[model samples]
Target chain A: MSRVAAFVFRRKGGKGWHWTDIVTWVWLVGGLFIMFGPAVWLVGSSLKTPAALAEFPPTILPYVTQKVSVEGFDKPFDLYEVTLDDGSKATLAEVRRIGIVSQMVDPKAPGEIIKVNIAQRTPVREMSFATENYTEPFTHFDFFRYLWNSVFVTVVATLITLVVNSMAAFALSKYEFRGRTAAMLVILATLMVPLSVIMVPLYSIVSALGLFNSLWGVILPTVATPTGVFILRQYMLTIPDELVDAARMDKASEWQIYWRIILPLTAPALAVLAIFSVVWRWNDFLWPLIVLSRKELYTLQVGLSIYSGELNVQWHFILAMTVVTMIPVVLVFIFLQRFITTGIAGTGLK
Target chain B: MTIDGSGKTGPRVGEIAMAPVRFAMGLVDAPLRKLQKVAGLGGMATFFLLPNMLIFGIFVLLPFFINFAYSMTGGSALFLSDRSFVGVDQYARLFDCSNYLDPNSCAEDTFWTAVGNTGWFVVLQVTLMIAFSLVTALILNRDLKARSFWRAMFFFPVLLSPVVVGLIWKWILQRQGLLNFGLYGFGFDPYAWLNDRTWSFAAAVAVSIWAHMGFYTLILLAGLQAIPKDLYEAAEMDGTRSMRVFMRITLPLLMPNLLVVIVLVLIRAVQIFDEVYVLTGGGPGTSTLFLTQYIYETGFATQLRNPGLAAAASILMGVVLVVLTLVQLGLGRSSDKNGGRK
Candidate 1:
């Protein structure tokens, strides 16, 4: 057996498969499918034609309904080539525009058109991708503007969150001050206060600050997240005091030491916070929904919600927009999956 | 004054005269130096914490008190100056139920309905969330093929925006959606998944689990990986059954994570607004309306836009959440203490 196989099947009974192994593989594969099926369905449905989407038995693959020109018909129609009684192939066309009329044209005879009374035409399921679903939303709505708003908000908010949070974390973790414990406790206590509880007052505060309809309204209030501070603080506490002392011995000011030494040493935790901050700011819906009423200021999440408004829920366009919105976060997750998992696990242990 | 190369050791009369001028400069710097000394190391700490504290004060701490005050008032006004103070009346209205058990008998039927719905949602969501998450974690922790790939697949949805998760599932669970299509292929009748009350609530719960189970799973997976290998090896050596080994060894060892998952899921399930709101719009006769949605609709969505009553409702939620979070923190602390001892 190969080394990996040996390791995998190393459950005391030498290098062989166990029942548990079979069960585990089966469960894992099934779980993977269940977890990913909806997303896959979303992408597939977005690429499907309206007719295919409305089919009784939904098609997983996107299909295009094409019109083919028969020998006798000048205009192209959706027709199926059929093998007649005598083994020669003829084209069957169902023309529904002028009542249900079926026409059969002999391939051998260029101009022979025979009217056939057939109830149903043979169904042809062709795999086709509607790339229009991706472009149609942009054509009709200001999707790019929403995209830009999302990106701008995410970048600015994440940067502010990192700087504010890291500074606080550094002080709490590294320094000895009169109110250090009290400050940490208060910060941790704020974690219990859900945003929903403070929504009304926070809204008023934003309005009072004259940031009501601005993206800054959304950005400012969320820059100093308590959870970000806690996570970074936990990670920062693990760093040795010797590093800070060494920097101080080199005549480095506290600010200089923090800027140069602490930030660099805590790069992994900072990266984790950056990832989370981006995701949170990018995906934030309710606050932005309340704050940003103008079409110009809507974030991607809000824009996607507007796309899925009550009267006309264009699932194709909505799904396409959802897929588009997920691209950046998905990219972030892909690049930093290890860090994210480690960060989460680490926090949990703490 | 000492010269570097030319070794002049003593101060001349001109140097002595300049010393007085320098002393005057020092006199000028006296208060500034004293201020710096007073500020000192603690001053640096204060400086580092000031920006975060300022923002946190304005946004978090201040709003907390403001929300309490708003809850005590009654009006459609956004500004407190325009509102009338009606102490506890909003809470009274929320609590005024002819039959407290029956939400329909309540004065504010929608709020009561939301409360009742959230109660059920939390119970069901947390239970299923823990079960599914634990199972997924356990399965993923095994020495299986493509382990990280499976882990990523499960964790990917957790990274997605709740809106995206809601939209994706909403499309899939619609009347002519993928679920219906699958059923139709098997010669089953199409069900209006989102339009029906029970199915809509169920759909909401299922989607909530789908979106978040990955996160809880990751936590539990960490817990599973932390279990010592020797215990499992000893169990195997004694030819212990797999189920018994899991129940006795794995489950018992994983209590901390399980508790964390439970409390976290409970809190999250209570605060579920984004997914359920987008998916069903608290719809099919308010079946899926949660507490957060109730606060949002009351404060922002309705024509009344009753911020006061919404604030009251939010305060009620805040109280419950605060208690739960305290319990969670306490559990975490106790667990940490225990772990430290071990």
Candidate 2:
């Protein structure tokens, strides 16, 4: 609240804001609306019933018409305010509509039908969620399978990426080995070579290896990311040489030194890389789209996109699933936002 | 065995949980030490680097070369043996245009359309993105109340997956969607934001900026804060106008960061697919079709899948990306060299 007040009036040690301060607030508020508004609307629309979704000049909140179980009706009757002949309004339960007239009954006094103009009655509505929108897809579609595929890809791929990339980082940073410079150059050189550029031949390679329609096809191809190795190597470089030297002095194997000393020290970098890998794998679409032709193997991203393509009639479900898809990453961001931001800033990693 | 004699913090609960892990590692340590005695440290380093390099070589490097071969071949076959190389025919087909500007005059009209669209998208999206990012950064650099709150709010969109970004916007911008609904409420006729070519193209640019501007804004904000305060104070003492101070001091120092941001945005812009793909679906008539989506559709989605042509298109796109990547690296190196001097 004070922030709102500050936006309104705070500026330059004066009681009132300067024009510049006003402009700043305008920008901030506009940013808030442009950035935050859509996500909020998505959540709201996801809860709205299909009929509610179709309304012209849509309601800001999800609203379903209020219904009441009258004393003698098979189903609950929709309640509405009816303008009587005397020009007074009373809430009544609507029974049947025939052209321009509606038969409504007062729940308190049953068995008597009051005829009223359909135009004269307005349906009473209450803000409510259609949780069926969320639950319905699970009973019908491969929602859980797609979710598991995404999680499986994210978790397994991230673990493999960590182990593989860190081993490379360990080798490059700790040793003065043959072709070290050449290895460094090769990795860094292809940093900009995204999967989109190489999908055609990469597909061929994966297919040739008989990994088509397999999660491993998606998992194995993108594990050795250049950016991951680069970020980890730079972080690993900062660990003191004395640790490795002492480990060697104790007659520890090189593998032991890397696994015990360097790996532990490189945890912060590994966390950042792990987070990056999780996001990359979770949101990965194009490569997986090419690899996994089968529906059961679709990740959440691929699944969401497939549904989105045919969702002219299924917006509510798609909206709910999109919200579901966004949960893990957003949760990670919320908790570790500062950590992630500072990590990127310090490393200048993109 | 390595001892934990360095500086003990406390109980080290995490270490305790990791006891079995280290114990297992100790078992391997003996065999590995024997292997190292036979092979030496250089060979161990090679062993460590081998797995990562093998994957990188196969998937990334080898396919990069194979991409060239695929471009030269004129067949729908995924296997190279099934393909016959008609040297540069795919490239020739791509260039089989009488006029460059009029995509309709070209043999591969859709390819040319995609090229034109991607070029325009890169120019427009990158310019507007950097401009908005700069403005937002400047505003947020102010010691505002709930600064972190505002920063996080701005960055929130960046965290969303591209598909989510697309769906959110699609719901808003579709006919009878939120925007139109709002317009109808305001006594104005709702416009079909996506159906029309110009508006949809504009929307592609706008939505891309909305989704990605936060990242650049955060980058630019860091750059802004990194500028020395005393330089600004010195200018203020000299009673210079705000614009003049910004032009003189802010821009020159912000150049390196701005350059990095520009290249990053440009690179991403040129490779745009997923968001715009889901948002416009290459649109009412291919108006929003860009290069990446063009290659994807051509290679995979289209009924008459032309693998050779798509490969050729991708290789051309790769050349452009390679140039941009080189420029980014050049800027990075130059900035590093000038770091001490600055």
| TM-scores, each model vs. reference | 0.89, 0.94
At residue B81, candidate 1 shows an lDDT of 79
lDDT of 2 by residue, B124-147 (tens): 999999999899999999888898
Cα lDDT computed for each candidate against the true fold = 0.81, 0.87
Candidate 2 local lDDT, residue A268:
65
Each prediction's DockQ? Answer: 0.30, 0.50
Error of 2 at B160 (Å): 0.7
Estimate, for each residue in A22-85, the C-alpha lDDT of model 2 and write its tens digit.
Answer: 7898999988888889998999899999888878778988998998999867899999988899
Off by over 4 Å in 1: A1-22, A69-76, A82-88, A92-100, A103-113, A118-120, A123-125, A310-313, B1-39
Off by over 4 Å in 2: A1-12, A69-73, A96-99, A103-113, B1-27
Summarize candidate 1's per-residue lDDT along B194-214 as a digit string, tens digits.
999999999999999989888
Compute the lDDT for candidate 1: 0.81
